[model samples]
Target chain A: MSALFDYTLRLADSALILGHRLSEWIGHAPLLEEELALGNLALDLIGQARALYAYAGAVEGKGRDEDALAYLRDCGQFRNLLLVEQPNGDFAVTIARQLLYSAFAHPFWRDLARSRDATLAAIAAKAEKESAYHLRHAGEWLIRLGDGTAESHRRAQAALDTLWPYVGELFESDAVEEALVNQGIAVDPAALRPEWERSVQAIIAEATLAAPAGTGMQSGGRIGRHSEHLGHLLATMQFLQRAYPGASW
Target chain B: MSAGLRERALAAASGVVDPEIPVLTIADLGVLRAVRLAGDTVEIEITPTYSGCPAMRVIEQELATALRAAGIGKFRIATVLSPAWTTDWLSKEGRRKLAEFGIAPPAGISRRSHFGTDAVACPRCGSAETERISEFGSTACKALYRCRRCAEPFDYFKCH
Candidate 1:
């Protein structure tokens, strides 16, 4: 519908997909400490998702609510980025994805906190703090793996290479960008690219890892289009709500 | 309590502790955001401890029973998911209760902004000799930490 609504849904979808993906690591983290950390982060992401979807529903003024948006929507209607829907692989791969996304998010949301939209800004303010912690955590793992034993280093490098293809889509500016940027309610995703590059480059350098070369991105989540993985994710994440249907215990 | 004093009656419910962390009461944890007396209708705004947290229903039941026991009827506890709950909402007494429960309270409202982090002091030993081995601990509310001086593993209730 409107750009504000689209932007809100996009944010909600990002949190929903990533939150679900992260939850998949509930029992499967490399370390017990990390398991708790990732789960806590997941809780935070899910909380953000609920708040965003609820707000979007409210803003739409058509009485959708969080459940309507989260459970009722089909796969193509979701607007999450591709990286978030990627399955959790090994410790290195998971951390690599976490590192990449958090690396971008650490700055992206920090700047988003300054948005003209008070609610969005408020949400971003809190999210920025949480993301900063997650980035540090993922950064530590990146360093350990990138400089650890031969196999560890190799796996870490490979994770980075595989995840690199999804990085471009995060910075791709689009129609929602035009609406929000024009209304002073958005930050140009492209505008954050320089700073994202500088910070990520430093982290990668510290990890002694090469930036995987890539020219194209697997973009198309922001406009209700997503990868194959998203459908599977939605099936699992939304099953309970779909089945229960108004039985609020 | 007067007919319009239902909220005042519910205010005495400082005994309903968060199920996960049993030491802090619902009131102390600040989850009981508001207990309003709207004529005969009591509307209580509850803030959940976490999203997807299973304890909301439990807390809701506890609240209804507490209100009923306190001679208040026709009460509805509404979940307010906005200004999403933060550790900042935690009362000072709640933090103390957490410490007494063997979980380290947040060092402060400020979160872990970056790495090269130092260990927060141990609640039991009162020594700055603690180490966070894992970011998440037994549950979403805590992080696994160890006290170096005491050589004991404990949970650190993370700042929200």
Candidate 2:
């Protein structure tokens, strides 16, 4: 049960953090269409995060609800991937980050849709379609920005290079999920790599963007050791609950 | 009496129109999945068109109001995720209503729709020559498109 809680929280935190990151683009997107697209994407991610948190709360059999789990947790306790918490940079950087993350997430949610746990399976079933849209949106931008112009190509490639090292952490397997994987309740993160690689490589090739050579990979976010960005993000995200303690609209 | 009450509750729930798209009722949109009576309480199941559809809360509230107006005192709204809502579930009547309302309903089910490759007809001019402006529109379930023939911008209820 604890393992399930940890595993679910990991998924929830990543979605919440990424959704919040995307929401920052509101009123700042380059175009009205892009603004709506980003907002919709963020909405889907945050919605999925809420469902996961609710499921985790129920699994823990504690009094903690989704609100408590999301806004009450401190930075050291969050279990999201470091890639999601990385600051959204330029338009190219944002698209690159989304492409990298959604490439993995689309396949992850599809596979997870078949999980033995009914609640997780249900959430994944809904999320898989949403992630497919997210992946397509990101991939389209990646190709456009990567191959459009010399400056765009340079920025896109630079963004990819800067974010690639963080990709390795997404596939790292740990004992926390091993038991659930064996029980068919959790997906093996390592198993998702080949498909993720194939999908990402095809997009990169089409975009005329060279894939970065494998660098010294970053890890530890799964264990709640996140980059410095997460603390600041959480301070802003958790402000309402932290300040008011159980305050509601 | 309970069966009649269940039928009444279903009727009231079915009459509730979507907050985002007022032309379509919950029944027409296929979001209202099931309704039944468990003793004195009414149980209603609804599926969200999108995971983050903000209109869901409004729909729930409107449902409560509808039920109360119908004299239903106790009811519960449950959100079901399996068999996730799809554009295919949009009733034929719903599709017609959307078109009459100046929105192109989903053309068909195609994976290519995700990339805006599938051609959607313009609801206004009835022309099949349309270009996608964006894969998202005013709502999550729609994509923005423009008719080259008519030079009119419109919304396409994207096939999910």
Candidate 3:
């Protein structure tokens, strides 16, 4: 497989999977305002995924389009980070996961906006703005929940502890990312680590929550190895297309 | 196609109003970016104010219908996501229409991280003493705000 194709698919799959996870909260959010916010955020991610998938399909010179690439791919073929595919445990868990991912995504997309690939740069430029808002939203919630009532603080901290192990995978630079970074087509994930740490730590400090102690890194979403959660997510997400082939709204 | 025909086609397509903010046309909203005509075929390029905006599909359908009604045939509508659409593109006429229709126009260029503490002027009473109720509004492109002066809640077509 082409490195560019793999790299693009990695980005697309992460967005698609995470967007699907967020959409699962559409009607179930803790509050009416949160429902709208999560849904809107999900839409932005899915939109980013759609653009990336379209570009990936074009670059691969495949007959596949966005829908096919999204729905037809099996679990082993998916390249999303394991962090994104994890289930939304509780409101605090969801907030924690989003906080970590968006912190990384903001700078990652910012760097990608300057990519030599025109299409990638354009998508990144747009996505970076959206990711910034998403990070803000998550950060706001982190502070609110952590600094709120005793129960809320405990739950927030618990979620953070559970989700902390996944953060390492985000900054791990593999062969695909290494090659693309050298070619000026991809941002080096390792380089984004410092900024991500500083921003996340600052938010954690304000929230009055202690950062989770570093744990063993669980990696391998870039190579299509994902947690058990992705399988369940794909089953629901791809159900309509699989059940009725070529279905359109 | 003649330049006159192309101009006519562009004028007709420009008349398609944004489905969400009916007070403003796509032209006024700055969503309609370009129109091209070759022979009998026309191509229209539009940018979405927000990435996941549901109004985009409606706008595309309306644009095609408007062009067809004007007797233009073989038209294609393309959505360009680059240089992402900004409220800066909203025309003066669009801002006036938004305020007149009771929706506050965006105050400044949309930034991702900066949720401005700067007060938004109330569209109802022209008071700068407005407070944001929620960052996410009734729609993806808006934020809910209430005027301290008039006590009226309205949607602000957010900078993004």
Candidate achieving higher DockQ, 1 or 3: 3
Model 3 chain A, TM-score vs. native: 0.98
Ranking by DockQ: 2, 3, 1
Tell me the tens digit of each residue's lDDT in model 1 across A1-249.
878888888888888788888899888776676777788778778877887898799889999989899899998888888888888878888889888888888788788888888888867776776787778888888998888899998999999888888999888878778878888888888888887788778878888898888776788887667778888888898888888876565
lDDT by residue (A42-116, candidate 2, tens digit) is: 999999999999999988999889999989989888999999999989988889999999999998999899999
Off by over 4 Å in 1: A114-118, A238-249, B1-7, B36-43, B48-54, B74-89, B109-112
Residue-level lDDT of model 1, residues B55-141, one tens digit each, is 777888887787778777677778765566778888898888888888888776755566765458888888897877877666766
All candidates' lDDT scores?
Answer: 0.80, 0.92, 0.89
> Per-residue CA lDDT of candidate 3, range B11-65, in tens?
9988999888899999999899999876667888998776677898899889888
Report model 2's interface C-alpha RMSD after superposition on the true interface residues. 1.5
Q: Give the CAPRI rating of model 1.
A: acceptable
> What is candidate 1's TM-score against the reference?
0.88
Assess chain B of each prediction and give its TM-score: 0.89, 0.95, 0.93
Q: Any runs in candidate 2 off by more than 4 Å, and if so which?
A: B110-116
C-alpha positional error of residue A52 in candidate 1 after TM-score superposition, expressed in Å: 1.7
**For residues A49-101, what per-residue lDDT tens digits would candidate 3 score against the true structure?**
98899989998996889999999999999998989998999999999999999
